[model samples]
Target: MNKASTARVTLDPENWDEFRSLAHQMIDDTVDYLQNVSSRPAWRPMPAEVRNSFSEPVPHSGVGAAAAYADFRERILPYPNGSIHPRFWGWVQGTGTPLAMMAEMLASAMNPHMAGFNQAPALVEKQVVRWVAELMGYPADASGLLVSGGTMANILGLAVARHARCGFDIRQDGLQGAGKRPKLLVYGSSETHTWVFKGLEFMGLGRAAFRSVPVNVDYTINLALLGEMLQRDKEAGHLPICIIGTAGTVNTGATDDLESLAAIAREHNTWFHVDGAFGAWLRISEKLKSLVAGMEQADSIGLDLHKWVYLPFECACVLVRDAELHRAAFASTVSYLAMADRGVMAGGIPFANLGIDLTRNFKALKVWMQFKAHGIGHIARVIEQNVDDVQYLVDYIRKSKEMELLAPAPLNIACFRYIRSGMPDDALDRLNNEILLRIQEQGIATPSGTTVDGKFAIRVANTNHRSRREDFDALLEAVIRFGREVEMK
Candidate 1:
């Protein structure tokens, strides 16, 4: 007997009234934290003592949930990645909505696993996936699965592509089983997100399996160069398995020529996969939809709801045009998961057969609630506002004598560098880096750094809906002030 002396026990609270009181307090604290976030630093370094707090050995007994909430409030919420702050222009991150937070709470309380299930969660997931696919202009019958984030979504898309093109049963026999297989390869611009390459590697397609096609001055894929590479690869008897197009390159937010890339993929008889991780949500913006034109032509696409869609963390989806191909890539015929024609299993659409994860979180609840709480029209308006903010910053940068715009202001990223007359490239690099650290250390704003066309640039990604021109103005002032201060030293 595991516990002979224990009272007949479950994890449920002994007193519902007391538990409800605690829950209400936590909810209020969370709401206050989010509502008042703008008043705090975009990010702050955690103290050494606080860091040491986590070094204690794991305990066999559990602390009460209320006590745990106290630790989270004191040690965790104040030390977040700062992606939710109004001035956080570092990476392509979404500022989550309050609706998503409450929805997640309900999802946790339900505690339902969505893989291979016949339940309400399965229906919600199916409906949300359809809405997402329709928003992105995919066919009504297309197949999709909720995944952790963009990277896994990309992997799932590529896996389907790999299976379809290889013409061999990759599930039964991997890359090696095919005798004398041509060096299978995918093509992408130099500016494609690093996640694609990471996906390729994780899928057993080594990094060398990707061909780096050059991009034009505007950072769009150079069509002529892409044509030449495709032709040359065919002539050399190598397989062009897929063409990976990016709707928004992370460094400068440059969208590739999707229509042109689609044509090339068709001519080459290869799969066209788009990694529209953060930028695909540009579909929400009527003003910017033209930039991602022909996104509908992709055989598959990877999208991150957590990025531009403003959902909570780690929510993304992959949609495949061919439902049969997607199912063939991942479906299992195990005895326990057999489909039924009646009773509990009859009505539910099996989710585990669609992707890598068999036991998946109820990610669809947050997405579904988001759509129901704030309609797509409201989301689109916010997207349009962010794009306008990017343009506003670009205009401000051009008028600033001390700052030189390094790349074209495309989409929502503006790459620029601080310049003082006659500052050598080497000296400018060092000074700008120091300036970045100084601004961050001072908690003025958080903008990440990147090399734009071989020149170090301060890369500002304005994807937050909470941002306004005043925030951008403050960011610029901090950059200039820090740049001048660092130059003096």
Candidate 2:
């Protein structure tokens, strides 16, 4: 080949020094953004032009790294969902930390495929899983997997429960071949997250397989009604495969009586599973740990480190008490992935054998680094502060004549609505809805809305470690100002 034709092609930067400079500048810009996040709006609507810019045709050629970075800064950086904002309390989202952000970059640079090989990344994931299991009081020897979020975590836990308790070879014959088998069912409180029903549907059980047991006045599952339903289902020839208990309901943070629920599951010989997505982290808190007393007794647990542990997005875990049973549910023997006694392919059980994803990312790096950087004690204190902030808001609502506390604030979520005298329930709902829209549109603070007892409520779920008591004050002041403005309209 001629000299020109012999030139090699590579993705490396043409100028190493220039690329290094650009990388350093990017890191500096990120630090500046994080430090000054509070000065920006919690959220803002994108302008029409900014929105239209995304419709530009893809570049068939190439945009240099510098040009791409500039585009990101101009168009993407300014518009986020506002979960990172200090005043954002919307939908149980976590406000990430600087340390975790840096850890994410490091993990991406390494780019290790997490599907089990004899690699340090696999060991890191295993250690992270062990740390989470120990923190939640689950069995130390339990098998666990780091999943995307609460929904997947819950689904995996329930899948294991089904495999263990179905009394048939579910993996071999599938649900169709279970001839004359009783219809399998799952149970959870009405206050449970929609993940349970969605998980049932994904597992081919249909939504009808989930029995929505009513809750008590406090929003915890009513044990009496649950027992009665279990008896009725049994009489009707339905088999209860799993009993899901909610540790912290999304609406109001009301924890069910987990100990009693565990007892009931034992009595019925059903698998006990706890959906502790955000609340399970309370086990780290000395003051709040008592609320989730019986969670340790669960056959399996689904929890989110992203929400309560304040890690970045897409980090959650599902822990199963019986490691063997967990492996049996998801393990597959692929000839190509066959293990060797000693080589790059042999060490610990591949995470692929425990869950659905065979090609996984190094999601455990951020979790591991965050836990190491900030010890459990410090994290627990942050959680306690969040709960205290919510309690303060609840007390403020109780004292204010224009606001109503619609649900109990047991942990970090407070559900209340703005109200005026002589307004009917329907009118009040409309008024509060307007206030919520105004608060969001005005970029004062992002507090999500939900219906509590047929009344529209402004739901504040405080998972933001950056949140201060003053942020709640700002949120309340904006709510009142917007409430009056909407009422006048």
Candidate 2 error regions (>4 Å): 1-7, 171-179
Question: Model 2: clashing residue pairs?
Answer: none
Clashes of each: 0, 0
Worst 10 residues of 2 by lDDT: 169-178
The prediction achieving the highest lDDT against the true structure is: 2
Q: After superposition, how far is residue 40 of candidate 2 from its true place, in Å?
A: 0.4
lDDT of each: 0.87, 0.92
lDDT of 1 by residue, 347-410 (tens): 5346788888887889899999999889999988888888889888899889989998999987
> Candidate 1: where is the Cα deviation over 4 Å?
1-5, 171-179, 347-349
Tell me the lDDT of candidate 2. 0.92
Error of 1 at 160 (Å): 0.6
Residues 1-489 of candidate 2 have per-residue lDDT tens digits of: 556856788999999999999999999999999999999999999999999999988799888999999999999999999999999998888998999998889999998888889989999999999999999887778999999999999999999999998987666776577776788999999999999888999898899999999999999999999999999999998899999999999888999999999999999999999999999999999998999999999999999989999999989999999999999989888778888888888863579988999889899999999999999999999999999999999999999998989988889999998888888999888998888888888888999999999999999999999998899999999888877777544
Top-scoring candidate (TM-score): 2
